[model samples]
Target: MFVSRKSIWGHTGKVMALALTLALNGACGDDDDDEGGGDNKPGDSVKVTGKVTYDFVPAVYSTATRAGTLAFSQVTKKPVRGAVIQVRQGNTILSNATTDDQGNYEITYKVPSSGSLTIVALAKTTTPSIQVEDNTDGDAVWGVGTSLPSNAKTRDMHAGHGWTGGAYNAEQRFAAPFAILDSMYTAARAFMNVRPVQFPELKVNWSPNNVPGAGEKDDGNIGTSHFSPSDNEIYILGKDGVDTDEFDSHVIVHEWGHYFESNLSRSDSPGGPHGAGDVLDPRLSFGEGYGNALAAIILPESMYVDTVWSQRTGALAAFGFDAETAPSPSDDPEPGVFSESSVMRILYDLYDSGSNESAYDNVSFGLGTFYDVLTGPQKATDALTTLGSFVNGLKAQSGVNTSAVHALLAHYRVGAVTSDFGDGDTSLRAIYTPVASVPYNTNVTLTGGVEANKRQQNQYFVFTGTGRTMNISVSNLSEDVDVEVYRRGTVVAAGYLSGTSPESVTFSSQANTQYVLVVTGYKEADGVYGASVSITSP
Candidate 1:
């Protein structure tokens, strides 16, 4: 029961000597002494046990009203699962362990008689390889620690929210990083259930100074919580008086969904600012919609809540919506294939079991079905990944209720669910206009309200090559234009000259092979433009 450290050490000395004698007498191989035996035997160390937990503030949201607040009063302790634990005496690590699902860890280390020890729990895991770091602090890993010797052998470290009395203490926000890690773990595990995947190391950057404005990431002016495909990093907002996303599980998972798409599936979205009411490009609509739906599915909750707190007023405000329900036409405005709201509702309906208010949602294909298509056909489709491409892939699956899917699609006003490129919709132009004749020329219109990636900002064209050299050009006297040629989702050629008109590109083509041309304005120019394509014999 309560054994003295001195007595234990004495007993361990006897056992070590006996083991060393046995090894010297040919009882074990020479490698046995080097392999955690002899002087570094298990009997020479003391077993350390502990649990790592962090305080969690759950969001209080209403499914009916689609709004909620951070329930600070209902704060609870959640296990810091799959996180690294280290026992250190000063700067030297004596032992290391990983917390189990229940936050329990066991480590063996030779306890020194004089020096004090500390237990540090890091917000990191090696299996899936994820780490949360403080951007303001030289990108140091976030962690919490407790004096191990002071707490005796059964030491437990609990990261507090740092909320004291009516205000938050900056030094006490130790729970934020762990909370973010838990949300990522939930999302990653959900996807792993459907498909076995080896995730790359993901670094999540967070800081108390991180606010809503574009600036240097190291200084913490991160603009907003977003996943950067270029750097493959996630920046989270943690401005104390403005906004903090530590408790916004949906928001965290939503950003993680983007990471999932980039690594596991495919995303052709022209990254930009988009919202529910905006008329976005079909690619952006589908990408954003899938993110929202994936978060809801991973959370296994229809309501998506983002809570914000004001320190001065001590008030909490939140705004969200039920991903399971379709928004009103007035709220969504353009509810169709180009609307993110429509895409989110359609995707959620496809995966969810049933909804009491949704009359048209009579199908539940489950997460496995959704994952299969997202990772398989949708990733390889020649056309941009849009609602049309996703639905077309779903319909191809055996035993899928196509009629029920059609009803959901019709409810969203997305027209027909036939082809990857919107085929049967007359209201929308053909996704790729065809250049049937050589020396083909046409006038195209680009009209939008200064938004760079809206539906009306760009136009697409297709052509069949005849084993000859081809010249493509776009002319706009008053506006800067750009052109790009693609074959099977890969760019063959592009013209992106700045402050210039009549941009052109040339390339040799193979016979009977189809190529797509995308023409757009520089900085979203709004005017009529002329485009021409001609073929010459090699």
Candidate 2:
């Protein structure tokens, strides 16, 4: 725990002062020994006060192109709130402080008369547990240090943008880490406003060398700005010539939303590459759409912008969109529950008070409504977290306007979702077939959509375990198949052999427990597959 010296002084300053006086008297033999020590007495303490600010580059969007550009001339100094401030003399830390809302902090500690001190502002916090580090440098925490005044004088620290005549200097890119931390701080504060939440530790990795390519992360090839659930860390792209996202608050908060879902809510998305105008898997659609909407809600504006640099002209450019409006039919031909754009529009409409042109969005339930559904029902729903499940959970809330929700769903080509399993939609009603008897066999057709993990690549089934060993298998003669058994939101057994016609798994089950089975075509190929379930007695 990072304890603030201000609190300690406020609570026990008298006792600490008495103890220090007694120790100083014992060490010096008598008070007369330090009489000629001038203003630097043995028990004398210096008060250090300062403010931390960072240069923020805002994105200016063009209405005609629907994109943005970095307005370097309009850079403003913003407060670096809730960051750790440390005063150290060589290798020993003298005192600690935390910046308040106005970016101001104060620390008082005994300072030696001869040694110089350095004050550092770290991009970290203990209450919400967020840290920013440069992955290229042994994962060292990013900070800026300056010499502290020897006397009780005021000092300040500013992180500049490192912008020069035509480009950014890599050596002076001190504002990148703090920019990412500020965005995450805004996101965490928004959630805490709705409800008191203790967020898990989240580390954000950013470096000037982090480029956009698939390779080793430590070597600065970070593929893209995304959240890795396997490591529970977020990697932001900071390669200057290719793409840089440290100043893009929406991009940072969007990835933070994925972290929120992984820890706070629930997500069953089999992570993949997805973008606008693509018909995605329902799980991916919901997850991505929720991320987009949550970022808009947390930030001050609804426009999402991501800045990039053009290699051809060496000019900065950006890709942006409005989360509050619906995309044109030409841009998004298939707007439905399987579309991320539709999901984002629907969710933003539900929370925003402004009138929407796309639908009859008269519902403004605020963040508290969405918070209740996400942390309560949506996290515990039996079905996968999708648009249908979210809508069902929203309608089940105490005083939600179901009529408006139905209207919004209808506008997106989705009817009233009756259950978490999507019973209202005919195409999804038969998704989860229940097996009542032993030796159950079913023939299912797997259709390859425009891409893998979209719509028809998998089939689901459910059954009740009899406290005995069971064999679950899937076989396809011409294509590879995989099978998995899950109980209570976790996979108990799985078989995913490559290039094999049949995949099987055997596991002992508990009595009177519900189990789910999923059979999929390897790589989401188009084929006819056979799935079977049978119990083996002891």
Candidate 3:
């Protein structure tokens, strides 16, 4: 049996061992480890065996897929290969084994004087050992299990233990999935209080060999983690001598938020790189800000930390920020509607219990309120969804405290929010254009771009329907633009094209219904455009 002499599971300078014994009804099928059979014999141990499997949660990620159909979550399972299993007695190691491609493992070792032996599986690699498929490929093991897919194995290990938190280690690598599971459970609990929902199994991909430029250009970037909607997979960073994200609970939960958003609700976010203080695109701001805030809400901790390590040393330890600072200072030179910092602060302040006396701590609606709006109208709003759209959905809910909600928003410099479209809102730095009104048969000309207002770049037009046919057309556009018609918060018809082209749409309308015409540039495309709306009222 090989002994473990290094610390793992994020604990620094500590030791851990697994115990196993054949005394419990010949605990292990094979009695080779405990040959003496209850007779006091030196160098006698026990054996253990089991199988490992990882959970996979399939949810939609592409905006097109999500918009075309209502996606539901479901769980799938896959066997985990090459995870390490070990047996120990008290503080001493006895035996170890490596799982096969089928995830089966059998280990035999010698106990160090014990009445009962316990066995555990270590998800890391220790050199000068056996039971591995490839020693040079970095195909080290990770914690695996046969438990319910929704539950994480790390939580099971920490059960009944008072863990005061630890540093980065191999054992901690197994804990990351559990940490994300904890966040999902918190969100599920909050939402189920009003309406029930199930979280599909999520496949977490990580390894000690994962590093910068190891895979595809966007695929393998060290210290970067993302949830790919196309494949319904979560890829985390694992750097051998540098940064690894397995122990970064906040980061793990943040990526989980994207999964939740894409599946449970609707996210029009143009996914891209963003930071806390950057003035991002409105859609990107709301999605990223929601993720950051949700991570803190799930942990309910005073601070959110992300650590980076290198060469057996912590390059950046516990580098994080306060979660309670309202109207938080940001790195962006100018803060406005597109500021994720402002959005996150506003959201946290709204959900906080108001136990403190700060002006930003007066509102206390909780996560239930937040979840309700996101799953309800906000998910179906007839506007380019943003923070304002979410706030409007909140106000539309019954039993919501309007005073507290508005007060929380106002505290963050988001002026009086009276509609879902967020029209006519003017910031201190720029004049935001009001939504154009396209009466039954009126033609309107408008100009919009990412550089026009810096924040409110997407141009919106509103019209009242009359249970007939409505035809909308856009022409004279200088750049690639798409026009979508939204009714009661869902896209009814869209004029999406591959290149620069005129856009047009025709759809049956309900009487007295309010329809929003969303004319937005594709990515960096932006320019002036003319639109005409004609209605054939019966």
Per-model TM-score, in order, reads 0.84, 0.87, 0.59
Candidate 1 vs candidate 3: the lDDT winner is 1
lDDT of 1 by residue, 322-366 (tens): 788654434578888888888888899888884474788888887
The full ranking of all candidates by TM-score, starting with the best, is: 2, 1, 3
lDDT by residue (1-538, candidate 2, tens digit) is 1111122222222222222332333321222222322455545787767787888998767546766888898999998899988777665668888999888988777867667666777778766879887676666777665655455355566777888957897656678888999999999888888788889988888988999987788888888998988788899999877899999888999999999888888787866778887877787888988888888888867888889998778788887878886545444567777788888888988888854355577787778788889887888876767888888999999888888888877877877789877788555556677778667776777765345566666667778787898887777766666777877556799988887557878999888887777776654444444444343324
lDDT of 2 at 158: 72
Model 1 TM-score? 0.84
**Residue-wise C-alpha lDDT for candidate 3, range 65-125, written one tens digit per residue:** 2111111133334333444555544434456676565656676665344344445544432
Show where candidate 1 strays beyond 4 Å.
1-43, 61-67, 112-115, 165-167, 309-315, 327-330, 355-357, 427-429, 437-439, 464-471, 506-514, 522-538
Q: List candidate 2 stretches off by more than 4 Å.
A: 1-42, 311-314, 355-359, 523-538
| Candidate 1 collision pairs | 213-223
Task: Show model 3 residue runs off by greater than 4 Å.
Answer: 1-196, 209-223, 241-243, 308-319, 326-336, 396-399, 423-457, 464-478, 484-500, 503-513, 522-538
State each model's C-alpha RMSD to the native: 10.8, 8.4, 13.8
lDDT of 2: 0.75
